[model samples]
Target: MVDFNVRLGLTPTDLELREIQTKRPAEFEALSADDSPELRLVEAQFAGKIVSSRLFRGEKTITVKKDKIVAIAKALRDDQETAYNYLSDLTCVDLLKVNKTEEEPRFEVIYNLYSLATFERLRLKAQVTEDDPTIDTVESVWPNANWNEREVFDMFGITFNNHSDLRRILMPDDWVGNPLRKDYPLGGEEVEFTYNVRGR
Candidate 1:
């Protein structure tokens, strides 16, 4: 005998939620750079933290590291053998109304990196704290980062350290707040009309 609410999807199983947590090639150990240095140097850098990473495969992933990002990127590019010369893209993540704890950073900054000499591709990620929400800009090493960082800051409420012009690119300059954070109330934060009112 099941209650109507239970049959109507009001309850979820623990196993179902646990299964959703483990996607392929993405686990806590997998996030560390030390874990996969033999396979990929970049992986070793993010050791034991997959919440900040999205592994696309054995070789590539997207990471969100909000601290010392510029330094880490510079080290990789000038590593002689790993000279990541290509910046494929820079993007932002918008996780609306998620269970984000203030102890952890909430925003993602994604970098698509490539080595011209070896024709290898890797992705880097850095997360920014909600209060400050800032990371060093990589425009010095990759000029393309200039525009990309600006776009992220404009739309996603990120602040790039040492960015030349960190201002709104897509939205008006006087925009009130970043509309992407998980805590942001969706659909204007309240249901305007109720199903009971329709009576259909």
Candidate 2:
């Protein structure tokens, strides 16, 4: 028999595995506001913008209003203290079945940012309603958001306003329905080809 753990370098040293085995689940509670400098910076700068914030398992997520996403993103990237200059990833989540209130939006767009200077990371979320599934683009702040926003548009049917060259990146131009939505029908469908299968 082969020792895959040693081969793959998965062996833990300094009692790492022992610590994980003895850890308590109760230690995963949300951290206080003072514990997160990023949350404090956002709240202090953009008053009334943050809807909610939580720091759990060393990850900080701040939920903000949909309309203010662009402005907030710009500020965070430019701020000397925060300097969240790296746009690590931008994606969306379907919250139709999980929504607790009628007023809650059906979609939530998440922005993962990292600050190279501070060596810290933060996540920002903005809710989007099915009625108007649109929000301002963060491409102005982070140019790489162009493709990330496009992928979200293609998969989740959420529009990023003023995104340069906003179009389907993964799906065909004429493809109907966003595939990543929870409500999107499963299973394959018959696709009508615009071009001949064999060369004429």
Candidate 3:
């Protein structure tokens, strides 16, 4: 038997330390203070809608309320100053096991946006509670969100309101549970084998 275990050699903390050390002083300061230009713009435009923001490894992520995501998405795309015209990806994260305190919501719908002119990227996260795991669809702003949203729905059971065809893209319609959810069971069936010999 071949050993398939492989090590990356460095831990996540090491990677984070390296990122911090490699950044310029000004850039490091900006990240530390949460004062990036894009973050400032988002705060200024969507003050009340934004719940929280964080910077990690030079990447900024803004979290918004589920109900306010559509308006924020529209502004991010249509606003001249922050013309994030591209919706690179849309997905969901199940936070049931990740949030030990259970103070946060059960699901997070993530939107990866990009600007063609500025060549910048931003990640928008909207929290959805287990009781109400639904959010407004962004397919109106970017057509590509249709399939991505479907996949998220199929995997996480996070519904996207106003989606044209909100059906399972990867899993079958008869599928019982969302596979990606943390509480979902790891299911497998036992196999039986029988051997017979006629002549030895």
Tens-place lDDT per residue, model 1, 1-200, is 22433344443453245445744542433444444332254445544433444344455564544565776687678777678888989987754334556565667688888888778877777776667878889999899999899888876788888898888887667766565554432332223365645655
Query: Number of backbone collisions per candidate, in order?
Result: 20, 0, 0
lDDT of 3 by residue, 1-200 (tens): 11111133444464345445554543322233245555566677777777777776767788888877777888788877678999988888887755246678888899988999778888899989999888999998899999999999999998899999999999879876788886663331122245443452
After superposition, the stretches of candidate 3 with alpha carbons farther than 4 Å from their true spots are: 1-35, 187-200
lDDT of each: 0.66, 0.82, 0.77
Give the TM-score (vs. native) of candidate 1: 0.63
Candidate 1 Cα RMSD (Å):
8.9
* Clash-forming residue pairs, model 3: none
lDDT minimum window of 10 residues, candidate 1: 183-192
List residue ranges in candidate 2 displaced over 4 A: 1-31, 191-200
After TM-score superposition, the amount by which residue 190's alpha carbon in candidate 3 deviates from its true location, in angstroms, is 8.7
* Residue-level lDDT tens digits of model 2 in 36-94: 76777778778898777777778888988888888889888888888999999999999
Number of the top-ranking candidate, with lDDT as the measure: 2
